[model samples]
Every structure is written in structure tokens, then in C-alpha cells.
Target: MKTMILTTALLALTAGSVSAQQVVRLATEGAYPPFNFINDAGQVDGFEIALFNELCTRAEVSCEWVTTDWDGMIPNLQSGNFDAIVAGMSITDERREVIDFTQNYYPPAFSAYAAMDPDADIEGGVVAAQTNTIQAAHVAETGATLLEYATPDEAVGAVRNGEADAVFSDSDYLKPVVDESGGAFVWLGEPVQLGDGIGMGLRKSDTELKATFDTAIQSMKDDGSLNALLTEWFGGDDAPQF
Candidate 1:
């Protein structure tokens, strides 16, 4: 009886280990371009997707990608709907209170104002920003008439339709829009640098998962793979260094 019990326990332990090595579910907001977006094939594709895949490979883990709206991301994470968030989520103290974050993969960048009119008043005019984002907070703090949208694209649309005087968001996101706007939209003022940087969000209880990703991130940084990926996505040679 004792020998049989020992064999059963060993088998159960092996099963548990196998389960822990299964695929990790990674979530992202598929609407954010360059960072993460739905490609023409109706699949999530972008810098974040590529980077996450590489990270998983380096860590010898498998991953499955899922798209979730920005508003529900943190809530879903907390409720165990997914394993980790690879969305373009910035690292801030407020967010850190709710969810733990891996080391920053992307450095904190500037937020710029884009408007149809060059002389639009950034401080007093109606400024559109994606709801629940750092840009929205910045607009409110600056005493601007803040118009919150569900998506970044909608914020830009508010400016185009004259509903808002300006749209404030990441320069990486807004720059491409302005360039393709045929001179219709122009940057209004200097960009504002906010937050620490972008990092993967994980449940506070998932310390092992976080450590796995953190090690992968550090490995990429040490080997220059992370910087190479940044330049590939953001363009130019200004990729941040560790």
C-alpha cells in the first residue's frame, strides 16, 4: 500500500508540472497600431506580437494571443481571463497598485497634440484622448476640455470632424496618421513625456510568469535583440538602451 501511494503521488506531481508548462495566454488591445493591431488576415499582428513571440521562445514557453478592449483589460486580467497583457500599457504607479508589471520593454515616449488647425489652443480647446489613458489625465490636468473616446482612432476622428480642437496621444501612434493626412492634420504643440515606460501586465499573484518574462526581456536587451526590434517598429536609431 505504501509503495502504491508513492507511485501515485509522483504521477500527480508530474502532471502538475506538465500543466504548468502549458501555453500562456497573452492578451492585447488589437486596435493599437505599430504596437498591436489586426492585420489584413484578421489576426493580431504588430511589434508587440512579434516581440512577445520572441520572448516566449527565448523563455522556452508557449503563448496564445487574445484581443481585449482597453477598458476591460485590467478587469479581465484580475478575473483570470488571461495570463498576461502585452498591450501598449505604460508603467505607472496607479496601475502598479492593481497589477504587477515586467521590466519596461519600451521606454517612455512623448505624447503630442494633433489638430486640423495649426494654431489650436491646446490648454483651453476641446482635446480628445482615449479614455482611461495617461493622455486623458494629462488633458484634464492641463485644464483643457477633455473629450474621452473609447479608442485612439476615435480621438483622432474627433479632431477631423471638428468636434475637438486637438487630439493628444503617443507620438508613435499620431505621427503616422498626420503623415498620411495629406497636410490636413498638423501637430499643435510640443510633446509631453509622461509615465515610466511600457511593460507587460500580469496578475500580482503570477510572480513565476512575471519572472519568466522579465528574464526573457533582460536577455533580449543584453543581446541587442530588443533594440533591433524597437528600431524595426519605431524607425530610426533612437531605440532606448537598458
Candidate 2:
């Protein structure tokens, strides 16, 4: 999943409440590139990192980054481990049942299939997807045998190593791989749009923080800064602007 990936166990939600904390801690997967990833400096870097900092500045809110594994991301947030999550997580109805999300920062993107073999059977063959992602859910409905991986990289690796016929994921993440694979990878079929878009996930009670960030995000869009940031990270053509 490009825009959305990973699934976390549903741990018991702690009845924790946040007030005007001095430092607003935000977490990211630190694995999804162009959205969020660890850099050579061992720091979280990418579009979302840049966006978080800028948004915090605009909102006059003190904030810091926290790196967390994607598989248990939701549970950690629910348990008061972080103030928010912005790790390319999608805004879906099912997810909304667990947590609240601000307006989308990234527009909806199509999920596609990629494989070493061009004729890979995406319709009913073995398909790889990140565990509990929209892609995996979609694959399950497509009548394909879904292979779930804890990380998107592992899902792609399944396709590369012949463990899966094709891997279904967000095209933004896979397009670069296919373009740079030297013919080792090719798209298997048409892409399908999933989720509304990507957004910041917060606990249901964090309405004030959500309103603050939402206002900041809308300001960026109003001032044309959001479009510029989108272009900088995802290129003008592929990334949807405000």
C-alpha cells in the first residue's frame, strides 16, 4: 500500500487523556519512502516529516517525531505512546471506527500489482500485500490467494523472490521500484483506487489537536504551499495537488 499500509493488533485501549502537553509527539512508520522513511542520518525524513514540522510551526505547537513499527502503530497510539500517527495511513470507514483522522494530506492513490512476470495472475493467483491493508482486503475479495506481510518491503520481496505471483500495493511506492528494476519488475494489471486519502490519525478525544492541525493543513492549501510540498516530494504529475 502506497498511501495506506500495515495492520496493528487491537490491544485494549487505555483510558488515557491528553491536555495541553508541551511537546506534541508524532509517530511514523519510518519505512515508507517518499511518505516517511529513515534517512542516512538515522532520522525520520520524507514528505510527511516535512509536513509535520511545517504544520507544527504554522499551528504554533511544539512537536517531535517518534519512530514506531507499523504493525502495532494503532495500538501504540491508543495506549498513549504517541500523540498522533502520520505514516501514510489511509482514511477509511473501518479505520475511523478505531481512531479519528484529520482531513487528508495526501490524495487518494491507485493500488496496483507488480511482478517479475508480466502475465502474473492478479485475478486469482497468489497476490502479496501488507497485512491488514486495503490492498490485502481488496485482494481477498478479488478471489486471489493473499499473502500477507508485516511490511510493504516484505510484500515486494515476495514478488521478487517468486513467493508470490504479484504484489498489490500503492503505485507511488511501487512505481519507483518498477522504473528502477532494470526489467525485473513490471506492473501486472490496472490500478484500483482505495481509501479516501492519507491523513493524521489521532485518538478520538484529541479534537482540539485535530482542529489545530486541520486548520494548518488548510492554510497550506489556501496559500499554495501544500501543492508545492506535494510537488517537491511526489513530483508534480503524480501527486494530487490541493
Candidate 3:
């Protein structure tokens, strides 16, 4: 009886260890504001980080966050450096060929950033969202300039430095940039809609993790935790839903 009991305890301990060891490593473009921006002290702090922490708690899994460049995000995710991505990536069929995504988490809109000069023809028209974003189709359809930059900050910088006529991005993203730019740039108008909604990116093979995150996200939304976090970070609950 004693031996059997010891064996069962050992098995339980081993199982617990294995379960505790399970960690979902995530990659993000730590520069996108109100979503995954880095703070003044250079720590990760934003809506996505808060949401990720909440999901980690609900899923009862350990999570590790890492910063990656915007352009390199997909390739790094596909290469298996991380288990998933939650850096404001949009859900699109073209990206589906290479990876899977969770349910939409945030809405998208295209906002143009140009010099504060009102006379500038800042409208670059509808262009693609880099090469990998869902906005590729819109860019192709509209034949917009499709300005490309390595990072969100750099793209926004182009306008600040007078390098580009305007930088097009989601409205929430543009607001923070405008704030940081200190009036060097201004929003052209209400951000135009462009398949706006954010989603988590995961490898197709990690379908189980995707499902887990999806359920946890839904629960967070239902419980108002998601909205609360949005309000905490974005100053209101009217943030675009995913």
C-alpha cells in the first residue's frame, strides 16, 4: 500500500511539473502604442500586454513576451522562435496560408500622418499594410503609394522628418504617434476603414494553443475585463473591438 501511494504521488508531481513548465512564448512589435508600446522606462506596457497577462491567468499557463521588429514578426513566428504573436496583426486569408490567427481582437482604420501644414497633399490614398498585412489587397486595389518602413516608429518618422508625404496606419496607432511627435504631424481626418480588426497569430500546427487563447479572450470580453483594460490604457471603452 505504501509503495503504491508513493508511486501515485510521484506521478502526480511529474505531471504537475510538466504542466507548470508549459509556457506560451509570444512575439510582438513592442513599438505599437495603445496596443504593445514600450514605456518611457523601456518596459513592455500597453493594452496587448495587459490582455496577454489576463489570458495567461485565465489559461493557467506561463507566458513570455519578446520584442520583434514589425517586418520580421511573421518570419520569426513561422521559424518557431515564439509560439504565437499578438502585436496588432490583422486576420487575413493570405496570411492564413502560412499561419493561423485567433478571433479578431481590435478593429482597424487607416489614418494618414502628414506635416502639420494644412496645405500639404497628405493623402497617400489607400495603400498596403507593409507586405504581409491584410491591407495588401486594398493597396493593390487602390494603387496607393504603399509606403514601406521597417518599424511603425520609422514609418511615422518619415512624415515627421519630411521624408514621406504621409504615413498611413490604424487610427489608434496614429493618435499616439501624433502625441509623441509633439505637433510635428497631425491626423488627416477620421481614419478610413481597411479591414480593421486585430488578431493573434500562431503557427498552423499550434491549433490547440490558438483555441485556448480564443476561449480565454472571449471570456475576458464577456466579463468586462477586456474593456476595463482598454479603458485603463486608452482612456475610454470605445476602443475598436477585435
Reference-based TM-score of each model: 0.91, 0.90, 0.80
Give the poorly placed runs of model 3, Cα more than 4 Å off.
1-20, 108-115, 122-131, 134-140, 179-184
Q: What is the C-alpha lDDT of each candidate?
A: 0.84, 0.84, 0.65
Candidate 1 on 64-107: residue-level lDDT in tens? 78777888888888887778888899999999999999999998
Better of 2 and 3 by lDDT: 2
Model 1: lowest-lDDT 10 consecutive positions: 1-10
Candidate 3, residues 1-242, lDDT tens digits: the string is: 00100000011111122156566777777777778877787677788888887777777677777777777777878887777887888776677788888877665545443445555554444222444554434544553566666666666666666665566666676676677767776666444576636789898888778888888889988887777776677657555443
lDDT of 3 at 62: 71
**lDDT for each residue of candidate 2 in 1-242, tens digit (9 for 90 to 100):** 12322223222222222244456778888888889997886777899988877887777766767777787788889988888998999899999999999999888888889999988888889999998788889999988999999889999999888899999998888888899999999987788999999999999999988988889899998998988999989867867776
Give the worst 10-residue stretch by lDDT in candidate 2.
Answer: 9-18
